[model samples]
Target: MGLLNSLINSFSKTPTSLSERVTTLEIKTVCLGKELPDLEHLILIKDRFPRREKIKISIENETLEEIIQIADIPNFQQYQNFKNKFFDDELEVMITIDKKVEDNKFSIYCFDNFMSDFLKKETSDIMKAFNQLLKLNNYLIFEIFDSSLVPSLLLSTETMVFKKADEENTILESDRLKKIETCKQNSNFYSNSNLELIPEDFHIKTDSNSNLRNVFEKIETLLSIAYLSNSAFLEKSSFKIQISGHRMSNYECDINVQKLKNKEFYEIYKWTYTDGNPADKLIIARNAISLHCKNLDLINIDETVFASIKSNFALYQKENVMQYIDLKNKLAEYIVKLTTTSNDMIYGLFDKFKNNLIAFLTFLLSVYLIKIMSNQSVGSVFTKDVTYLSFLILVASFLFMIIGIAEVYFQKNKIVNGYNELKKNYEDILDKKDIENTFKSDDLLKKSI
Candidate 1:
């Protein structure tokens, strides 16, 4: 009676509340001719019956059902759509085996979505979480949506993407040939013999003039200019389109296939605005370039693609600014060290002037002393005119030395203070000993001095 009541309630779509419990329940879309292991309950819906137990199932419709047994139903292969559900102590799950379409894919909602308690669980990485969910020509997508019913992510496996592309096939033969012709015509490097070219394999020739990191940057700039030759930057911001599968044709070079396979993907399949089977070979090859909007559990998902590009630019700007500042500070500190001595003496034009002034004063004093001792005319040697001029010269030299000293100290303090402030603000990026060594190092850093 208890089991029968559970089944009756399941048919009504009422889920039992399981609080503070999270367990993984994985189920394939189709399981037939046998039962799953270690399940408390199961249901094998043979087909969408026109009338099953007084319930109208006239038209085939997608459904969510609950099962109370684990054993596989007998002769489950011929069923148009079969659903199996079971509850272990931790999770309640169901498997839908729909043979209606050859491309039988499933969607697993990772969030609770106020729908059921089962999908409320969380994981760091969705790709790793459902790696094995797709098996035996079967594939599943992990989707996350918010309260507003907007998808945060629509992720799937590589196999799922390739198969979808295969189903949809390729673009029109004329379209492929036209794109190839455009590529060949635009690039001067492509000769008559090397006529075949496609957007995926086409690249701007690299120049020797490009600086360290500027080569890639220049390529990006040129590509953008060519693509946006007639259109404004954000002119079609609101336009949206998704290309579907098509008849087969080789629109791109064979090299494009290898390039796609060799790509290092930092993130999973991402799509926004437009999705489904790609119509272009390049689009089909590099899957993640399809811009995404909003955080969808995948890595680096942003609300706007523009926002993502802006963020990357900002990071690069910050890094370059720091490098320039670091180099400038080192030069300032070097000047301070080179100009000053161990005894706090600065070796410059001012020092030379001070030494020469002292020597003249000493010579004049010696002459005056000798003339007085020999009973000579001391008044002539130490005349009023000479005395006044010597006094003025002494005062001027003293003032100049004071001003020079002040200027040197001001610049030295400025350099030291700047380094200290930068180190304090970026403490996490520096080591404990970096404060003392920043200005002292003369060794070059990665093409920088």
Candidate 2:
């Protein structure tokens, strides 16, 4: 009787608490033909539904449910249309597969809004977590699918950024040609050629400058950028769009189909954005430029380029300012170190300047004394003017000694205080890993609340 009641509840159209629980319960056997060993470690449940061979999973939220239903289409065209109506709410995809031997059953997920934004900010973090999972699982595959929701603005025919941030030496026509050449070469040689150039391979020249074209070349070579169809740095407009995918293994490059054969683990794919709808090639070039800016020495920043970066990208501003502060603080410490000496060395050098000053004074005094004695012996050989000059010299020497003493004292005291302050601050700053761990723990707590 209990079994019959449970079966009835599972199939019910009307929502009951038990029915809701059943919806959330992962039907593992349907997805992973064999029950995954050590199920506790699984990030997503592998569920089996013998009756419903056509797989379905539901979330507690209705808005999300609608988004999933919209995205559930199997073809790229349908998914592209669904992407056009993107809203602010988060979207997650749940996959189901039919029973098959080996690993035939799998599902893929894409973020809606909130998660997309979160993962965008924490791209490196997402990669780290996914790689960890890949190491743990022994038999899964992961890949990032490259699908263009919209064309990029920077790479688009309507848009052109002509001015270099530094100065006005025009991006010459020849330079533009060279960039195109590089792109053509990249298409022929590399597997992940920038998507913009993918059309070029078919003899469709979406014409642009060489620098912009070269950006496409680099994007073609880089795994992450090639898949996104736009640069990660989207300035000039705030319109938000992103790309994402999941991996079945660590070795699998998300955008490349050729690398999937050897992968044997699962990886949650990343969400990336290129705002302003810049051309995919332009986005790639911008990223390379941004990376170059980061490696610049702290003491020398190109003011014009920096101004442009500050005006355009918020992330660049935060990162550069933090780096600048660290650089300034380190220089301040070096200045303090150069002025101070070890305690043992200090004892040997202490009063050394004063002693030198004293010796010079003694030698002058002796010369004056000799002149005075000679004048007494010879009567008019030394006059009153000579005596006055001797007195002036003595006074000047005393002043010199006083100034030297004050300089040494001030420098020594200043260095000692600076060192002590730095020591205290150094003690307060915990290990980098510990600091990051604390931040993660705090975030988890806040999310729970």
Candidate 3:
């Protein structure tokens, strides 16, 4: 009874929550520097719908009629009009298919709703159908949005290339692509690519094996591609990839990589103004740029490129002034520690000097008392055995004073040595030499440009 009630609830849509529910989902594939197979060829494949029992397939109305006419080849315009009307938007499932071809790119979008369990279950079947369509392409990305609303679930594939080196079943086996694979393995940010009902909330799951990790991994892989791709930074680069978008509407979230002509560098920016936290987005941008900097260093890129990266770092620091203040506080604390140690050392030597003076005064008092008790003059007290004892006391006091003075001298020397070391460290931290050198190099580069 409980299971039946849950199933009923899942299928039923509340009028109050209608605006919050996902109205559409889209999947896009981009083949970098390569053209993809035609939409007509994919749709016309007779055996593509082998698993028809799992999910029903539908095209737009006119395209459906054209499919019925076995002798006719559906033109691009016919394919555009053919909407997947199998699912009802108000009641049941509404599925749609659209294909786009622009220059060297090809794209496809599959749109559906959230109110049906059947639609959720059949997502894998839909992807399977699309996969068969896109199998001939070399580079592909499968991206989907859970809702049209803000803070929605975004699942996407990492930019992947189909390699001829491996068997046809293995699409990502190229040795040259190891860097991207490494980034994917290390990233813990994305949802799993497996087909499943989208979670109601965008909060990260606490479990280690959740789908969110897969989503993060895919994002990292994309970042790696942006950071490592050389052609992305070049001018008039002939090699470009094919990309697809929804025919019905633009993607809710997208990443665009462009080469900056003036700076001669690549910029990878995300186009999701509605869905993400601004701070998180800033962090993602900074991290991607940092990774790009490391890559630039490894390749021994031109000094001007590094200078631009340095300028970016300075800009970032300027934007977040609070972080710079915190850094200043840390340096101040280190200086205080050094000053405290120097004070302690100097004070210890002064304490030793005070003790030596006290001891010498006590010796003089003892000599005076002995002279008074024996009914002798101060001069007479210095004769015979008394004289010997007085001389011994004097020698001992002199020796004690000399040792204290030596110890003070040694401590003074230590303080001097410590101060010199501290000074050197301060000088290094505040050094303007490196800054001057960098400025000179940048000026030379600017003149050349």
TM-score of 1: 0.23
* TM-score-superior candidate, 2 or 3: 3
Q: Which stretches of candidate 1 lie over 4 Å from their true place?
A: 1-346, 373-387, 399-449
TM-score of 3: 0.25
Per-residue lDDT tens digits of candidate 1, residues 273-308?
A: 123221222233222223331123112333344345
lDDT of model 1 at residue 136?
A: 28
lDDT, ranked from best to worst: 3, 1, 2
Distance from true position, residue 258, model 1, in Å? 28
Stronger candidate by lDDT (1 vs 2) = 1
Candidates in descending TM-score order: 3, 1, 2
C-alpha lDDT of residue 150 in model 3: 28
| Per-residue alpha-carbon lDDT of candidate 3 for residues 287-378, written as tens digits (9 for 90 to 100) | 44445445343222344544554465457646546643544565456456546655675677577667766766676677778888988787
In terms of lDDT, the best-performing candidate is 3
TM-score (all chains, Cα) for each model? 0.23, 0.19, 0.25
- On a 0 to 100 scale, what is the lDDT of residue 262 in model 2? 9
Who is ahead in lDDT, 1 or 3? 3
